[model samples]
Target: MESDLRIAGTNSRPDIVAWAASEDGKVVPWVVIEIKSGASSSKPEFVLPQVAQYASTLGTADNYVVMGTKWFKADRSFRRLEPVSGPTPPPFGSHGEVDDPAVVEPLLTNWLASLTREMAPRELPVGLPTLEGFSVTNEAYWRAAMRAIADTTSRSGFAQHSSSPLIAALVARLIGNRLEGLVLDPFSGVGSFLWAVADRVRGAMERGESPPNVRLLGVELEERTAAIARAIGEIAGVPTDIVAGDAFRVELPMSSAIVTAPPVGMRLPQPYELLNGRVTTDMDLAAVDLSLRHLEEGGRAVILLPRSFVYRSSGDAYREYLANEFRVGALIGTPRGAVPGTSFAGVVLVIDKGDAPGETFVGQAADDDWQVQLGVEGALTKAAVDHLDGFSEIWS
Candidate 1:
């Protein structure tokens, strides 16, 4: 059995490709499986046809479509294709439903055999080393590959690649060089910040240095996106716990540091119940506020917020609260269009559990120059470090 197997010379990659063994131990295509998530459009009428179309290319009728947990086989006995129920289990884990080995084992075995036969004559490209091995050995290559994947999959408004690798590295650096205990990301999309920290820690270890033992924790609202982050972490050999649930409602462990880029312009369905009867409609600010609660005293938090957050009238109360509760270490203005989808410029707000500063350091970068200043090497420049360190005495 193969999952997310890309069809040869075709853009359509089926969710699962199964094979069966012949009498002489030859593998042959057994079935093509297309699975739709519970939140996706997986109606029988719609998916059956799509699966059939994919199967037609393989010159086989053994195609199966699974929507959520319901599985259906396409029946072409009549003029129009009809869907018939099969012994296959419904979406795996729906309502804690377990797969019947008596029904599913044979199906999977046959599929695997078929796939083995189909690949017998093909010479595939050399696959890259596993993410864990490659990342530990080659930091540059791993960072590049991660950035490429992030850029390719990022969607404009729904899910954007907001944090740059440089920015992530800088945030991790500010949090601390040796981060022991838990590092939490309230809005970890693809685990960029987690990955950055992992790379840094692993690099130190590789240099014959003793880095603090750090555990990564992330909470994402979307299950599919959470799965992606988990997959990336697994490949990179980073021990990560990514929970697929509402961050506002989830119970979080006390963290040594927090770094995240909360979604922008999103309104909460209801007021979040924070400590001391505090509630707010702004999800972005609420995310930051919630993160603060989880941080241990003296713990650092690096967050990305819209530039308007500094001056918007609606944010006055929140800003005042931030001023009173957390030390405003620095506010680095990011170039416009820094984030892929939106024109809303952003600022990196660094906070620590300490005495509030009399003023916040404010710095700006030009659009064209920002690319150079925010790269891996650029992040370590004296100017860049100073901006993040609140070295400048400028007041906000």
Candidate 2:
């Protein structure tokens, strides 16, 4: 939805654009949304009238929200609710608005947490609460926790790593739905994938379903990255067996699913192997082969590859390797700038181990917003493909 609004250029428009939802299995009301910069100083006087006009034009009382840095300053005209504290009294005559990002962020966070709790059961191997009470107050703590994991990996010796909240959310959705019980990230960079996967496992426990013993078995060549991955799992309460070794050579425990985000080979040291007493090849094929080996006979895998790996003239070997190993489930065409700090467009190549009767190709809209593209849309696409391909058949 954020992607649609960003690309369609209709965030501030009056019409409600109805579309399929990617967040949860539900339809969302697409009303006008105004993103203001400063909510601390301005009263809702000028903005409320404009929003009211827009809502009237659409003939819907749907939310006309303004996201900015401010607190709730209540006026008699509009009703406002603060996070924990009681309803703030109307300001003087009629100054009603929400102030303070600190106050608002936690309020929104709790609301979202509540929504998730309502949707699923609350139990886990650890029974730790989600980032609700203290975590809400200390946003930096959660971030620091994630950073600690990253720093652990970096200092340990792993040079390549990525931190992504989007991946975490996707893992959460998958675990919540019980669509997958395990996650194997063969190219687990700096343990970001481990942290995200663990976070999802925790979320599954919170959502009623007995959180599956979701083991995150990752293989990292860089020792530092392996250490970081281990530290993140410890902190997040997710069991991770992150081994420091070549992803191609390391052995993986049996699992029902795999989610890997491999290096795009944009800028990385080339791998070398002594074959017949001489080093040969760039080693790209070796990584793909490793991904295939970890997948079980009927399991599904989501592997990230450079778009060139699909159609490049020189990619015949890699393509053939894929064709010979796993069943081609779907090829999602990622858009330009889909991944941050990288120039190339990504492709989420979904694969199922062993041959299948038939396959389908889905072309989805590339989420234009960088945050939504990386966090929401990319994960959503993978989950959708998993759903369409039938998780039951893969795991059963």
Candidate 3:
């Protein structure tokens, strides 16, 4: 909490912060509430931009959200608005009128909390009967699998990554709804995307629901990540065919719903021999090209890459390629210092396979309140609820 405020330059002596947690004692990523008195702006005038700056600082600038006070009816009904564009001006409140924290405090907090509330088991997908159903089904099983994988691997300097809960669920829901399912993670660092998808499958089974056939695949040149991914799949009771190869050279499965996280010029030790492949000293355009190719006709994909890819002149050709092959659904830009310990700016691009596009939903997920980010964009946040939904089926 303190670090985030410091990074945003919002830390102030008058600001009293409190930690937030779930009933189960898990630290709610929502972090703390900031209560202050006698500030000239009531709510900090810079708060919205500061939050936007914080988004950029956290590499989630594309997802900008500012929750503040609002008028409430006797029954506590109120309105919450997702900031579409521009900085949220001072005197924050619903309907662009009142700014007093006294009026705004309870309402804002409630609104934020509502956005972070977890789903009840009844609201989740029905449970499956056995390990034959899917790779992941419940929180209990997923944790157990993660722990087992962690146990097998050495602790030192190993990095594991996965798709955010939102991404995972979106794919599952798409599949459940009878849309063709094809997932490709170009920057399959640690197979987070695959795990998320597996978890979604598990959720559907638990809910007594089944999805149409789907294929989950990723490219990780590093052996360590690929090995751990395979092991995780085994532990989760699902069979995953994650190959050890460069994303550019690996053949991607067809369809759409591509979700990936590419490296942002971060120099990390790769655990593979660069055999007969072009090893570039910088970001690989070939990898991006491969991503563009893998999307099936009329499919949509989201890619998480460095912010420079959004505006840099060098990436113009890539952007142009995307424009031709896929409709540019959305472009979210982030500020510097977004990812902790890394200088790269983060951005999420939503793209469709062809000229026609679906409604674009974009929002930043800061360490401050990830659940809210998910709730505010519920349409795009499927992975978060997959576990509760249960796994209905799995293909080996």
Task: Return the top candidate by TM-score.
Answer: 1
lDDT against true structure, model 2 = 0.48
lDDT of 3 by residue, 1-396 (tens): 232234535553212222222333322222122322354334443344434444443332122222344311111111222323333322211122221222223332232223223432223322211222122223544554443333322222332344444433433443322234666676776566566666666655667776445566767876655654554455453445677887756666775566676665654244222222334334534445556677777666656667666677755655665565556655544344433235566665656665553334444555455444444235234332232123323321
TM-score winner, 2 or 3? 2
lDDT of 1 by residue, 68-157 (tens): 667666665312333557633322211221122211233323332332232433342223323221112234334544654444433443
RMSD of each: 15.7, 12.8, 18.2
Candidate 1 vs 3: which has more lDDT: 1
Q: Please provide the root mean square deviation of candidate 2 (C-alpha atoms, Å).
A: 12.8
lDDT of 1: 0.62
Q: Write the per-residue lDDT of candidate 2 for residues 172-261, one digit (tens) a residue.
A: 333223335567777776566566666655555656656566667777765554654554455566666777787655567766677767
Question: Positional deviation of 378 in candidate 1, in angstroms?
Answer: 2.9
Candidate 3: where is the Cα deviation over 4 Å?
Answer: 1-139, 146-156, 160-179, 237-239, 266-285, 332-343, 355-371, 375-396
* Clashes per model (N, Cα, C within 3 A): 11, 20, 35
Whole-model Cα lDDT per candidate?
A: 0.62, 0.48, 0.45
